[model samples]
Target chain A: MLNWIWIGLILAALLAAGVQDLGLVQLPGADAAVAEKGSRMAAVTEAAFDSAKTAVNIVIGLIGIMAMWLGLMRLADKAGLVQLLARALKPVLRRLFPDVPDGHPALGAMVMNIAANMLGLGNAATPLGLKAMEELDKLNPRKGTATNAMCTFLAINTAGFTLIPATVLGILAAAGSKTPHAIISTTLIASGVATITAIVTAKILERLPAFRLPPHDPPTADEPGAGKEATR
Target chain B: MRELLQAVATAVSSWAVPAMIGTILVAALVRRLPVYEEFVEGAKEGFQVGLRIIPFLVAMLVAMGMFRASGAIDVLKTIASPLLGAVGFPPDLLPMAIMRPLSGSGAQGLLAEIVKTFGPDSLLGRQAATMVGCSETTFYVLAVYFGSVAITRTRHAVVVGLTAELAGFITAIWVCRMVFA
Candidate 1:
């Protein structure tokens, strides 16, 4: 059903796009001017190449840093840095994710994901996301609807992460903007809004009765009493 | 068109391949490092992830290649042009956007073309370059993510990712606007 809904939305979007292409709507003033501006933009593309290099460098640099970081983090584990960090943050994470079991294995993965993203090392974040999902899958009390926690996590991931602003800053710098750092504020605002949006959406969706059904559901372990509501 | 092809060939052979190999070589060297034997398992994990993702990268790249060959890109550009300009995107950036989604090398080709066609410091060229830098290769990202996860159901990923690219596009334009305009 969700698949069909997704298909419908995509189809609708495509059709509307097609109609728009057919000239059913007036072209925006910006686009007309923008198209005209293309010839000139060719000039800027050259400079943009120089500017674009920073982000790629950062990304590539992050790759190297990750291997070192990973190796170091393992060393940190032996040296008790992770324990110290976790010990300090345990109170906060527990508060943020209340229903999650205190010893939930996902705590490690989630923190790891957050940290990697902060480094602008999204490629590095995948392992943690996968591990987090695996851990979450184990604790799923419902064999049905995605839980509030799951929904919330996905929302946070999708809404955008702001800790590392390299990608945007790199673009700004490449564009030769004097205010490359300007995005620091927007990052905070945008990511915060996204986070809030995700949290609210996840919570609301969790309460919806229809979410208890199959197919629209996240696969989960057998949980007592969770299935009774649907059968009723 | 020749420049675009050249850039892509360069990117594939020079940039991407070298980086991939260099990384592996570095890893290989580290493997010879006497720091610790226990780290091998973790090092091996990275190798496995790379292995899993490579196929996806190749597949998506091929799809992007097809998209370029299909002339669907010009259509996309015509559609995105207005929004592109309003955000202060130079027209040349359209090709970058068109090519960017498909491959970094191809985008680099477009970027180089813009630079060659125009002065490097030109507003449009700079903006297009910036856009290329700021965004991820959508096809590459999809390939890596899906291939790694082994997902049969891709869900709303393609849409959401494209939407993110649109956001990146608008952001690039706006930044260009505020600075260049």
Candidate 2:
């Protein structure tokens, strides 16, 4: 999937640039139409370089933020807060991931990861999420293929139900808005809906014929049939 | 009712991070954990994680930047505006709605530009901000999370992510209108 999306972006960029250069399609704005033959393509060349630099800068810029958040997360973990939080959420998580056993380490990592994400701590979220993925993979009999638990977890991550939206607020504040935080409630409502949709869709798709994992020998004690949903 | 929710949301957004950090420190202190040493240890991994993602971020962003600079995004936005406008979503937010799922930095850049052009208090600016906040970078999340585990057959994860993002984007616009309009 990533292979084609990456290829398609580059291919589409070149195609669009070529078409514009050939005078087949002009940009929508008056300023764009006044540009010379090669300038449009030149911009694309410049953007590639600029974007590469931006990518590196973004990562570098995140180092401090990541360090702080990860540091705090570690402190939380050492204090047993992460475990307590995970234990509190066990019932809900057990229902969400029926395949994982009652007291798997994956559950703890997932709780911390989702908690980090909700707090808008992207720096902490990714590492914790990957940890959860690795833990979940321990149960996978089939290597290099995602389990239902992994898919459901990723669904929640990608929906991104942020509580603070700190980045957005910062951007708006920097822009000198009178009420930079006004979108907070709206964002919560929207992201809340997205999170719900993601969970529902992932759960439903897991049961679909096309998406169901192929049957394999039961590796875990609670393993129901691979393609079949476990009856509660 | 709306004003009260807005005020509470504002207060929470402002204080949540500090409160979280403070609570963590207090908790660690109470537990007699070597907070400084443990933090340093975890932060060491943070550096490596940051460096590990360089190649992936560069690859994704370069492609996205080129696509945007080639004016394909503009063309798409132009084409999408009328259809989207008929549904009451501001056309200026189309770029945000499009770039959002693909690249986080790209969407933030667009959001900054949109807010600057439209004024941060404008209805369009508010909607764009809400939209970006409402979703994650779906492709980035998929690549990093699945890539970490060396999983290739993602099955329906991509579909689920995109579907969820679409739902978020639409809901952002609707909620923004209801609240801000």
Candidate 3:
């Protein structure tokens, strides 16, 4: 479905631009209407290229952050701290994901990811999240399809509860809000609701026949011990 | 009540990071782990993962930028304002609401613009800030996590994530109005 969403976005963009260019749909406050159609399209193309450059820059920006967190995470793992964290979070994780075996590394990674998100450490969260997903993927019976555990994990992370919201506070402070931290309580309440909703929705959806994963394919040579590994 | 909540938030925001780091370091030291060596090894893996995500990021970011640059977001705002206004949400925040699911930077820019225009203390500005703080960029998260694992079929994750985002948006508006108004 990501494929469909990506395609839909690109198509919708072109269609919106086309209708405006043809004067079939003239938006009241659209600045694109002021420019010539050719120029408007050129600007859109330019923005896409610029965003591509920005994307690469963002990845480069993430390297140091990712390295820092992942390194700490490795140390945590070596210290058995992550497992301890996982064990502490077992009651919550078990309810959220019953399929994941007890003491799995995915459990540790997921707990750490959620903890990072709650602290509003997004730079730390994303890499930890990716690590969790990869670890969960090891348990996936169907290689290319997202499993129930993966979906639930993604849902929770996407609607992650934020206790601090440091970035928003920084923006508010920069904009001169006398009470820049005022939104913190509201954000916590809202994000908490979002997380609960995500968990509930994911649980319900995964039970539906439509969202069920397909039958597993026979293990291929490249996936050595895939069957055995999944059983573990 | 509000003042107490705000005070707790301020305290957490000030000390949460240092506390987390300190706890981690102490735990590692107690366990006699070679913290530095393990860190370097993990950092190497992170660098590779960062490199791995570049193509996916470019694909998602370019698509998102093209959609916004095409004025589709503005069009969405114009179309959504009336319906949202009927429900008491400020129409002015529709751009940030729509962009929040698509692009983090785009939403941040919009939020900054809203705060500047409405004054940071104003109702709309507070609402926008709360909304920004309450949710993650759904599409971006989906892309990066799924892309890193090379998962082609997302199944229910997209629907579940968007539903959560919608919940966050509505709650943000409601809670902000209740407190700020």
Give the top-scoring candidate (DockQ).
3
Report the lDDT tens digits of candidate 3 across residue range A163-221. 87888888999999898877888888999999999999999999888887655456675
For residues B1-181, what per-residue lDDT tens digits would candidate 3 score against the true structure? 8678768867875686678667778888998877778778888887788777888888899999889888887777777878988988788988888899899888999999999999998888888988888888998898788878778789999999989988998999888888888
My TM-score estimates for the predictions, one after another, are 0.51, 0.79, 0.89
Model 3, C-alpha of A227: deviation from truth (Å): 9.4
Question: Candidate 1, residues B1-181: lDDT per residue as tens digits?
Answer: 6457435543543353235335544554554543354344344444444455554444444344434332344555667878866865565467676576556667766666665565455566556655655555655544444454444343344444445555656666666556665
Candidate 2 reference-contact recovery: 0.77
Best by TM-score: 3
- What TM-score does chain B alone reach in each candidate, compared with the true chain B? 0.65, 0.69, 0.81
RMSD of each candidate relative to the true structure: 12.2, 5.2, 3.0
Model 3 chain A worst lDDT run, 10 consecutive residues: A223-232
- Docking quality tier of candidate 1? incorrect
Give the least accurate 10-residue stretch of model 3 chain B, judged by summed lDDT.
B12-21
Record all residue pairs in model 3 with backbone atoms less than 3 Å apart, i.e. clashing. Answer: none
Q: Across residues B1-181, which tens digit of lDDT does each residue of candidate 2 receive?
A: 7678657766765676788789889999999988899989877766766676677778878888888778777777767888977887678888787789887888999999999999998888988998899999997787667765677788789889999999998898888888888
Per-residue CA lDDT of model 1 for A183-226, tens digit only, reads 45334444454445445555555555644324333433433353
The residue pairs found clashing in candidate 2 are none
DockQ order of candidates, top first: 3, 2, 1
Candidate 2 runs further than 4 Å off: A29-38, A49-82, A216-232, B1-55
In what order do the candidates fall by TM-score, top score first? 3, 2, 1
